[model samples]
Target: GIIFFGSQMITRDWIFNEFGCKFSITIDILCTVVSNFQVIVYTVAALSVERYIDAKLSLTLNNKFRTIITITCIVLIWTMGLLMPLP
Candidate 1:
């Protein structure tokens, strides 16, 4: 967005021709989708904890491997996010 906005402000138009235009558009869409998906991921995580609390069950995430699970989730989320914008 900053790149697009600044370029347009300086030249009053897209200076990068057709291919650059498509590349930039693809990048912009990917960033937007990834950020939106991150929000969804966090929301789901919160909901899972909430559901566990409501059920009066021991939190499954109390294990020593929780950090590994968290990292794996993040990596999968980003991988999906990156793939989602491709043709």
Candidate 2:
């Protein structure tokens, strides 16, 4: 996001050849998508860890179940992250 915004700001008063413009656009899209995916993954991981710690401290879930739940959450997180960027 920052990359794309900065590129736009920098190019506002400048002229780019066709190749340069295309390359800039491609980089912007790639950066945006990758950044979004990274943010989602980090957020999900933090939340998952917090939840797991809370459950562990409170003794609300057994170790095996907690492990299973954590794995499931991770899988879902990656799946959502991958699919959400398709649009």
Taking all chains together, each candidate's TM-score versus the true structure is: 0.55, 0.51
Task: Return the lDDT, model 1, position 10.
Answer: 95
Best by TM-score: 1
lDDT of 1 by residue, 1-87 (tens): 557668989999878778877887787877788777865876588568656664784455464565566677677766765566445
Q: Report each candidate's C-alpha RMSD, comma-separated, in the order given.
A: 6.5, 8.8
lDDT of 2: 0.68
lDDT of 2 by residue, 11-80 (tens): 8743556776677778668856885777577677769786778767856667788678668877776666
- Provide the global lDDT of candidate 1 against the true structure: 0.69
**Clash pairs detected, candidate 2:** none
Candidate with top lDDT is: 1
Candidate 2 minimal-lDDT segment of 10 residues: 78-87
